[model samples]
Target chain A: MKIPLPARFRTPVLLMAGLTLLVALATAIGSEQLNFTLTEMLIRMIVVIGLYMFVGNSGIMSFGHIGFMGIGAYVTAWATLAPEWKQVMLQGLPAFLQEHTYPFPVAVLASGLVAAGVALILGAAIMRLNGLAASIATFAFLAIVYSVYSNWESVTGGTSSVIGIPTVVGPWTAVAFACLAVVAAYAFQVSRYGLMLRASRDDEVAAQSSSVDIVRVRLVAFVCSAFLVGMGGALYAHFLGVLTTDAFYLALSFVTLSMLVVGGIGSLTGAVAGTLAVTLIVEILRACERGFALGGAQISLPRGSQEIGLGLALALVLIFRPAGISRSREL
Target chain B: MVDPLLRVPQPTAAELAAEGVSVRFQGLAALSEVNLTLLRGEIVGLIGPNGAGKTTLINCLTGFQRPTTGRVALAREDTAGWNPARFRKAGVARTFQAGRLFRDMTVAENVEVTGVGLGLDRKSAHSVAMEVLDWLGIADKAARTAGTLDYTDERRVGIARALVLPPAFILMDEPAAGMSDSEGEDLVGLVTSIPTKFGCGVLIIEHNMRVIMNVSHRLYVLDGGRTVAQGTPAEVQANPAVISAYLGADV
Candidate 1:
């Protein structure tokens, strides 16, 4: 789903399908280290696609999406954690989450729903603002969610990590969810509401005059985008078997959004491509930081170089290809 | 495809009116105590010089502006607090002086979005979009990126977007702004046919006296935001106030 996709829509769909195939092939044939990196990269891809569904179509950047991801991770963690673990760590949880362990699929569905529910309530108020003010409000929202989760000890385990989540999700499952996000986001990209959302983004005056309810369409996208990002968070919890609110804080927001800008903020292809390119680049940078022998000489970069490298990459993309590597085109 | 969206109920004797409407921005009066009416099955011309508040009145009638001292009514109900989007959804559409097409979208998407906003499913919206684009003779340009169009075609696409709404009262603001003489003549045919062909009332804002006079079933003339004269084309042409307001601008 590139921005300004020609009406055909098949090529971008095929592109996402192709991404799934490569992930499957990698996990099946590649080494353990490669599988680990692929899983993380695919999860980031799903998160970016969720971001694209709202930011790409509505032209509203959000710093709060990772906040949804945190909510989802926590919800899924609460659902799937061993009852004994929950009873110990999250004493303030409702009776249902504290005493019962749901099936993994049920936990996953609950994560998306809870995130979407929060989005609906918040978006109703925030979507009334436009442009920069709305963006800042979303950042504030993320900060508030972060502060609450970090301090709500009994319900959220406070600042401590909640463990004992089953680590059942692998690279193949990540790929499947990534593919599902792509198809759903693509369907929205071509649907009536998507077209209207993009229209409103292009020219608000023109769109409203055409009878497009600016706030309503924006809120709908906000809720739907939150649902997807929330599901991405669930995948993270299951993959790591741990939950930490700080992991879903400012750093995660910046890193995922950077992938979007580096790939193509306006197109679905850009979202996927950005995640793939940035994740791989960060992994390579880390691998370099941990010294490797090259022709009997130790080849290594200084520690903390990944941040510098990622920052430089983001800067270059912004200055040279402001539309992202996909140039906002799907094909 | 059946084009259910384009098959609007025929000519329900609709009326959009302004009673004693006036607008003041801070201290300057843009329009004062102005009255205008448009009815279905008719073509009405609203002509005035620059800053005469032709577009301002268009805004007021279509809910873009709230009159300081009057009410705008659609059919029989007062549209006092409606927004522009509600106005469009209620079957009143207006064009801007600036042809504000969604530059990044294809022309077809630009028109189809209106159908969707007005409650059509995507499939029906597409059918209506193609139907109206065909009617406006820009069906070939339906897939073209709207931003790439020349000024004249941009205006054409703007008109096509408005027509897709199938509005009961379509208020056109300088619909022929960038056209050549021949293109202007073509616009005359399109503007005049809107009432009979699409079953809508037309309010055309134009500087070109000849074109509006040629097509309007009735004429409403304004000067300095005041009603100067209104009647049949011949009656308004013979009025001294009308001639003086023209000031030899267009005879």
Candidate 2:
């Protein structure tokens, strides 16, 4: 009857600790290339977990969360870019923005805040719509973010990648944030608000009859998810040493989404597992494309095998286990 | 002039009243000028044949459907166009005609969410959830997925969810449909006990006359979207209009 807090968090905490340990071990024993791959994988895990926080809990498929990531990347770039570089590349930025630079942590936190602010504004209106209509509204949101950031010549460099972003993030940094995202996601799923949102997701009429404010609960999830996804974008910008709207657009969106579905769209464990599995598969296929030697003979996979293999694997997994590997089960 | 300042004492019990409530879809009338009242600690039954607008009446009372005419009042305040959540917060709760439990949640969670939604903290909500499940004799099924419950258990779970709110008024839509005779008797026991045990008024829309007659304190009969009769079961059974509505008038 007490609904003990620690007991509720056990699954998510264990999963987070387990992921962190796995990443640490990989960083220790694996080659530099593996560390790089693991870092990217961990970052993707954070983004997908952020996606799960909204999509899994609210039973709404959002195609626009990558837009939040885009917002985060630009905000981080705006905050951390050297003043000289900002003036030369981002001349469209106001003088105050172009003239100042903040610390890395401040830039990351600001990235999340800025993205959350945008999501709150959009979610206030978008959460009112349901079903495919809501999905379309989010898709429209993504399109708007893409177009604005792409064509905004002076501020975003007009389709050219913004360079000189310090590569400050590494494997451990990714692990830390991914762990934070997982904990935040777990905290949300086990909270009273999360339960209410899930109830609404299961049945709107019943939840409303129980006095759950569906719109408000959904907005909470949307904003929280955007905040984390925004942070993930910051991590990406620092890792890549460059910022591009294209990085957080359709390609990454589909990839993150596919990972979520493959891992199980219903649980936090699924988000991490799916990202790791998909990233590993992609790396293997890329290696195959690079002509790995086997049995003293050179074997070369056809180009674009990663895409074809990923698509085939996702199709097969869905066909066999429609709920994904975890089927909503927590770690 | 004498000072007019005075404070009125609170009403002893909550009351839900509908006056001349009517519902129309396009040009078709589903209910016309239907009036009903439910008071705390009372059990009332609304009975009718299929398509008698019984569900439509439930929808209007619970604020899912807004009547084109008339007012639905909570206590003395008119709440005609209030949303379902508003109705719930005002202490009105209802079970669906079919138990629409949160499919992904466990049975306990299904009940706990209602308590949480009604502003109970986690501990209190969990306590209420466990209490309701135990009261309904389905405590063992607390951790089972609500969607996997059998028909009878699902119905019990629905009642348990409604009870978790500590509601002042609960409207049940066809709670005994598809139930066996013994199950109907069990339901009669449950419905009869609700007003006294839970301290809430009940408005049950039931097609089965046996359950309705055995449990309800009063009965309102509807026919063709209009009230045909209202009285004690014996009185309504004897009324010719009520008889004609269920059977047919002499041709």
Candidate 1: where are CA atoms >4 Å away?
A1-9, A292-299, B1-13, B248-251
Per-model TM-score, in order, reads: 0.94, 0.96
Stretches of candidate 2 off by over 4 Å are A1-7, A294-297, B1-13, B249-251
Q: Model 1, A30-134: lDDT tens per residue? A: 798888888888888888999999999999989899999999999999999989888888999999888999998899889999999999999999999986788
lDDT of 2 by residue, B32-94 (tens): 999998889989999988998999999998899999998788888888568998888778889
- In model 2, the Cα lDDT at residue A203 comes to 97
Give lDDT: candidate 2, residue B29. Answer: 92
Residue pairs with clashing backbones, model 1: A1-A268, A3-A267
Q: Tell me the DockQ of each model, to 2 decimals.
A: 0.82, 0.78
TM-score on 0 to 1 scale for chain A of candidate 1: 0.96
Task: Please provide TM-scores computed only on chain A for all of the candidate models, following their numbering.
Answer: 0.96, 0.96
Best by lDDT: 1
